[model samples]
Structure formats: C-alpha cells, structure tokens
Target: MENNMFCFQCEQTLGGKGCTRHGICGKSPEVAGLQDLLIHMLRGVGFYGQKALEKGRKIDQDTNKFVIDAIFSTLTNVNFDPERFVQYIEKAAEIKAYMKELAGEIDGVIPAAAEYTPPMTREEMLKEAKKFGVMADTSLNEDIRSLRELLTYGMKGMGAYGHHAHILGRMDDTVSHFFYKGLAATIDNSLSVDDLVKLNMEFGQVNFKCMELLDRANTETYGHPVPTEVLITKKKGPFIVVSGHDLKDLKQLLEQTEGKGINIYTHGEMLPTHAYPELKKYPHLVGNFGGAWQDQQKEFDGLPGAILMTTNCLQKPRDSYKDRIFTSSIVGFPDTAHIKEIDGIKDFSPIIEKALELGGWQEDEEDQKILVGFGHNTVLGVADKVIDAVKSGAIRHFFLIGGCDGAKPGRNYYTEFAEKAPEDTIILTLACGKFRFNKKEFGTIGELPRLLDMGQCNDAYSAIKVAVALSEAFECSVNELPLSLILSWYEQKAVCILLTLLSLGIKNIHLGPSLPAFVSPNVLQVLVDNFNITPISNVEADMSAILEAAATA
Candidate 1:
C-alpha cells in the first residue's frame, strides 16, 4: 500500500480543488474517503438521533461517543491512520443501525450510500453524501445555502470539541442536542437564510454552553488556572512534551511519571495548564516547549522528549521525530504509538519510559518562564480591575486577535493587526494561531498587560465572560463596548467560536485567511449583510478600520 493519502476538507487543499492522490498532510485516498463517510454518517445519525432524543428517547454513551469521535477524527492533521478510520466507519455504521432499530423508520439514511465500499467510485460517494442531511436542500437562495453549510461546518467543529470533553466524563445535554438539532435543521426545507443566520447564532449559543461545561469539567478536575511562566528551551534527557487540549491525558502522564524523574512540558494549547492548581501542583511538570501547531515539524525534531498529541491542531509530523510521537483518544498518526484505553484509563508509561531512556539535559539548564494560566477564572478574578481600567479610559480598546492559523502568508495580518493596535489597547488571545504574536512583548497599558493570554482555543469562553462582565458593568450590550474581534481561522473549531459570537448577537467581526471552502456565495452574503463579517484587509487597513469605526461611533 502507498504511504500517502488525499483529502480536501480543510481550507488549504491541493489546487483549491479536491485532493486526488495525496493530501498535503500525508493522508491517503482511503483515509480521506473514510473520513468523509464518517462525517456523512454523523449527519445522518445526528438527524435521527436528535429526533429520537426529543421524543424522550435515551441514547447510550457509546452511540454518543461514536458521533463525537467521528467528527473529531476528521479534523486537519488529526487522524492519519487508515486502520483507525476504518474502525470509525464500522462504528458509525453500527450507530446508524442502532438508531434505525430504535426509531423503526429512520429518515436520513440513504440506502444506496449506506452500503458503499472503499476505493469507492465518485458516483457512489456523491450518492452517500445525499444521506448526510442534504445540505439545506430547501433553501433556494445561494447565500442562505452557503451560510447553512458554513454553520454546519462550525457545528461539526464544536461537536468535535464537545466530544473530547465528553470522553473525560464531561457531557452537556444542550450541546449534544444542538448537534442533533443542527443536523435535523439541515433537513428542514422551510429554513430561510434569516432562519439559518438565527440558527448560526444558536450554534454559538450551544458552543458557549459547551465551552462552559468543558471549562467546569477542566477547572473542577484540575482546579482553576493561575498565572505562571513556561520555559521555551528543550532540556536534554528523557521528557515528553504534551500538546493540544486534553487535561485528562496530561493528568495521566503526570501520574505515571510521578517518581520516574522524567520532566514534562506543555505545548501549544496545553500551555495554560500552568494556571490550573491541580495540574500545576505537579513538581515534574516543567515548562512549555514549543510554539504553535504549525511550527511542530521544526520544534519537535531532534528533541530529547517524546511528543504526545491529545486532540486537534495536530500538524504533519516530520520524519526526524516521527518515531517518538504518541497519540491518544481520537487523534491518530499512521504507525505512531497510540495510547490505547486500558481499564478506562490510558497508561502512558511507554512515553514516560522513553523520556527516561532518552535522559534529558543532564546539567541544570537556564530556565525561563512564559506566562500562562489566564483562562476565564483568571480573567474573571481581575474583571473588576479590568472594568475599572476600561472605565477610566486607561484601556482604550480590547482586541481579540485569536483564531486558527493557516499556512497562508497573508495570515501575517494577525501579527500586523496586533502590532498596529493602539497603544491603549489590550489584546486577548487564544488558540494555536496566537503564536504569531504571543512571543512579541507588547508591553502594558496602565496596570494591565497589553497582551492577555486566554489559554487554549476553548478559552474563548473566557473572552465571552469578560465581554459579558464588561457589558453588565457598563450597562450596555457586548456590541456597545469598544471591542473588536479580528479572527484568523483555518479549521472547524474556529467555526463554532464564530457561531457562538453570532449567538450573542455580537456583530462587526473581521474574519480572514479566507472563509470556509464549503460556504456558498449566498451564505457569505447573509453573514456579511447580517453580521458585518468582512475579510481581513492589510493589517494597517484593518487596524485603521477597527479604530475608525470606534472613533466614528
């Protein structure tokens, strides 16, 4: 079998056309098709599953887990293993069959698509897609249809995050139901672009709830995040750098390495773990090791520590460190060591042992601390002071310059936008994309730091909390405040966050690095007409636009 595969679900694909032979991320055609089938089936399951639940039907955890995991499995650079995806396909079929059994007359299953096989014909694949809720067939308007598709993609992203949270015993019924609702809505022909726009906001509303639930699960289990500095340089010896968003995996790693003398460091989204009281309590938890997800090939190569990926935002691994990488839960890389579930808890002793055998830096190296731990609690803790700063006119503007980063060079717009921000502004950042500006010292305004790090992508919840708090303090809506959201997106997680923002009725958001490949023209118009969603211009132009709008208003 050839080692390469093809996929085009992400914004950057071969030729802006469908990937035919091998995906940029190294996925083969088999894996790509399987991932599509998995997503198509998820839509079907979500359609029937939501209806079943509404009728007071109770769905089992396995069925729920399957739906969640299946979506997460399709994210960029997340799943590269064909065997694992094949299993997911089987699992999806199982769930669909189970739901059909329960419902007696399932509406979303397309018979021709249900029995399709791999190395499948394009015709067969297209027929199978018909079963996936039909992409808002009732909406004749292109804009409405496009927006519906965009919203659907966003829900898929949110569902993926929600699923990760669910695996750790954190389940939100509202979030789960929305997945069903959104799918069912796709099948509803009466939905207008206006209706879809409203649903778009609901996507955000549900995502907000989902984020809160995950936040509660994380803080409750790990304790609230606290401010702490992380080290950037790698120390020689045996160590493992854990990245992405799964604290459960981090906790397990910590427990396994308690007395083993292997050092642990958080990378990317995991950087904020330093703020959590419980996870931070570990002495061996050393510091942060790398930058954003896109920089992983350079960061992880020739490193002394093993790399553990817990969730999405995973990049293609470089050959240098490929053998040393491990993935757990829904993440899968071809041929890498996958941490399998054992007795409901994954034992990461292999990663730990590898770290010990590698023998990290022998001599104590110069340690540096990078500040993190500013999740919602950390921000809320200082909300009163933040409110004061804004009231006193000390913090002139609040710029939320965070979202997914892509390979596009134009994405440097985020860095420039932040760089060109007014002196009195404060920057709130989250997700992997923040790496572009995170290392830059923007100094401070008044007593507050100009750049405030808000943990991982899910920590967008923190930004909302702060925004709502500001709104309450000022006796105005969130839109009334002197805040602007300049987002850079490349994946589905960003989709859900945008939906959550819309749900809050927050408008005039500037999104860039191009919109989703899936959104049709009609949908783009709806987003622009209703939400004031605009593409990112040059940094200077965007900054001026943001500031000019504030000044004029």
Candidate 2:
C-alpha cells in the first residue's frame, strides 16, 4: 500500500493541489487505493460491456445498478470502507467475466487499450491500484489532465443521482450507455486535450439526463415541492435526524416510525423534504435539526437522538455521536451499524430504538423558521407575477447563489453575498449551499419571497427549467435574461451541473469558493474565454460587478 493518496476532486483539496497524505474528507490512503482499483475494474467492465452493446447485446438491469453504485461509492466522503470497495471490485470482476462471454459471442474479444487487468484477488487488486491511482495517470499536458479529471468527477456526480433513482425503480439506458462511455474515456490517454475537453462537455449533457431522471423519480414519488415553512428548531419527544438527499429512506423511516412515538426531522439537503406533499402529510415529520453537513459534528454533538446518513457529505463522526450514527445505501463508516434493505424492505428498528432510549431535547428551545420548496412548479406557478414584477421594475436583478456548502475557508463569501444582495433582486438558491443564509430573513418583494429554495442539488434541473421558460417568455436567450449564476462547488455533483450549464452556452457564471484544482491554467483559460466564468472575490465587489454588467446589458 502507498504511504499517501492523491485526490483533488472537491472544494477542500489540499492547498489547491492534491491531498497527498490523508484525505481531507477523512479517507485513508488505503481506502483511496481501493477506490482507484474499483474504478479500474469498472472501466474494464465498461469497455467489454460497451463492446457487447455494439454487437446488439443488452446490458442487464442489475449490471446497470451495480455500475452506478460502484462509481458513486468513490465520490468524496461517500464510502470509507476498504472492505466494501473490495466487495465492489469482486462484483465488477464478475461483470467483466460476463461481459467477456458476451463479447466472445460477437466478432471475437477485443483487447483493453489500457494497462490495467482485472485481478483475481483483493490483495492483487490493491497492489495493482498503487500503479494506477489518479497520480499515476498524471499527464505532462496539464490541460489534458485537467479535462480528464473533470470528466471523471462529473461521472461520479451523475452516478450519485443515477444510483438514487435506481434504488427507487427508475433507470435509463441512455444514462447507462454514457456511463460506460465516460468510464472508457478515462482510460484512453491517446486522446488529446481537445478530445478530452469535448468529452467533458458531453458529461454535462449526460448528467442533465441523469438529473432529469432523478427529478422525475423524486417529484412523482414525493410530489413536486411547494412553498412551505419548516421548523428550524427541534421539537420535544424522541426523534431521528435524517440527513443527505435520499427521500426514499426518509419516506420509509416516516412509515416505520409512524405513531410509534418517534419524530423525524430533516438535516442538510434533506431540509427541503418538508415541502413534498406526500412526505409532508406525515404528522411526525418534525422540523430540521441543524445547518449544513459541515457543521454536523457540533450540531449533532450531545443531541439525544439517532442520526441516519442516506448519502454523502458525511464527515468523520465525533466521539459524542459516533455511536448513534447509522448509514444506509452506499454511505459507510467503519464501525457504525448500517440499516440494510432486502428487497425494498429497510429495517429501521435500530434507529427507532436508539431514539426511544435517548429521547430528544426536553422541550422546543428554538423558534426559527425558514421557507423552502420553491421548485420549478411552484416558481412557475407564479411566473406571471414574477414576469410582471420584473416588467414593473419591482425586481431589478436575479442572482442565483447555490451549490454545495463546505467547511473550507472562503465559503463565508456565499453567506455575505446573499446578505448584500439589493432588496429588489430575487435570490434563487438550492442544494446544501442554501444553509448558508436560509435561516436569515431577506423579506419578500411583493407577492414573491426574496429567496426561493428549489429542492436538492439535483433540483438544479428545476432551476434550468425555470430559467429556460423565463427566456421563452421574454423572447431572449437564457443568458440574455436578467439572471446571474453565482455558484459554489464541493463534490462531483457541482462539476456535472457546471458542465451542464456550459453545454447550454449559459455564460458569465461566477464560480467559487475556488476554481477546481483539476483544471490547469490552460484549461481554465479556455473555460474563461468560452464560458466567461469568473471566480468570486469580495461579496460586495462581485455583487457590484454583476449588477453593473446586468444593467449595461
């Protein structure tokens, strides 16, 4: 095993370089090594499966779900279980063998262009991984390296959304086809920087499809989000805090715990769950428990309830709550008990018993309230009012301050940016990033709320829908509308969403808390020149610049 790991996929990458010692997200070098091997085997499966597809053999549904989970598992802060990766590698190898059989039925077996070969044992895979980590694939052409990394990161984000949707009985073959295409592209170094950049843009298109699929799954299952006020304070009685963006788990928890004298509350991206009509109908679904995922350690500390993590942005557990933390789906922490589902039946009794034993706060100690659930349907419901407001000069500019919220430095800029927006401007925010300022009062502009909280990060598709509809209403390009996208990036989801925006030719996107470490100078220059992307600086300064630009346009 290597002494250090190299990962630069998220906002907290070390010094805008790679994390060469331990992961900023709490993954060890050994865990990172296994993830590399997992990806290597997946690409091999992709190469063979893709060839089989070309010969008219359809990949099975189980293989599609397996590939989605396998890619998403390697995302930052998602899975830290080395043994879990070992299992995923073994499963991927089995798929590779199946793919080989399928390929054999075709024109004969085609050799893998890359040096990696499927390992028979976990130990062999771990050893071979050392020679094939992200660092080992490093190219002297920084621009090419950067583009390749962008494609891989975007796929991880796409896989996360795909995995969630798959779990809920929805899967798209188009998404699966490109999943293999993107993975296969990662191992092809003969492709030039230009070739990789072109593929990176395609990642945006595929990611949009994946996001759209997840959006359909969520809206159809949970009902489209509407304006609703959620309690920021905890309520009395025993409760369970459900975090991450998995609504299916939340639904099941609410079902299993109904009338059992336990309360359920949303945390982080789960906060918007309050707006869904189906989930909101449950009487025991209480208020939110904390701020963003980054502050969970302090917010969760000493809180007398069980916390269930359904997805990523999971930090290392604090000693105070580590014992009570529960994981489901692809999320894993070494010693914590995981709630597993067998054939759609997830047993959550451990979480229920934990809450019952610990109990929650004695009484409601806080009274803060935040408004959310302004999904595209809700926003477009009042499109005429919004259009009239802009036409009547009641709304001057629209600033979109959204993306993942992280514990890293300079994230405070988002809080300040939202705080300093002019009274007439409508701030549209989504994802975990909304936690930065959701608790604060921005007041309303006429009939509209000053800040609109569209669902989770996947809800960026809703934002795009609203944006495109607004463009059609005004008879202008989306960029020509009175809008600006000031976004913050943390994980691969943001990467895929950014690429989607670029694919749409939406320009002048202000991106921060910092530019991606994977994007080299030359590649960034291309991004700036093509997309007119700007890095965020002082809030007041960036705000002034965007406002002035909007006015001049």
lDDT of each: 0.76, 0.87
**Which digits, one per residue and each the tens of the lDDT, describe model 1 over residues 155-237?**
77886678767866988677777776786666566778778877887788888888888888887887888877777766655
lDDT of 2 at 143: 73
TM per candidate comes to 0.90, 0.97
lDDT of 2 by residue, 307-358 (tens): 9999997888988999899999999988888989898889999999999999
Model 1: how far is 272 from its true place, Å?
Answer: 1.0
Clashing pairs in 2: none
Q: Against the true structure, whose lDDT is highest?
A: 2
Q: Candidate 1: misplaced stretches above 4 Å?
A: 1-8, 15-21, 105-148, 187-195, 362-365
lDDT of 2: 0.87
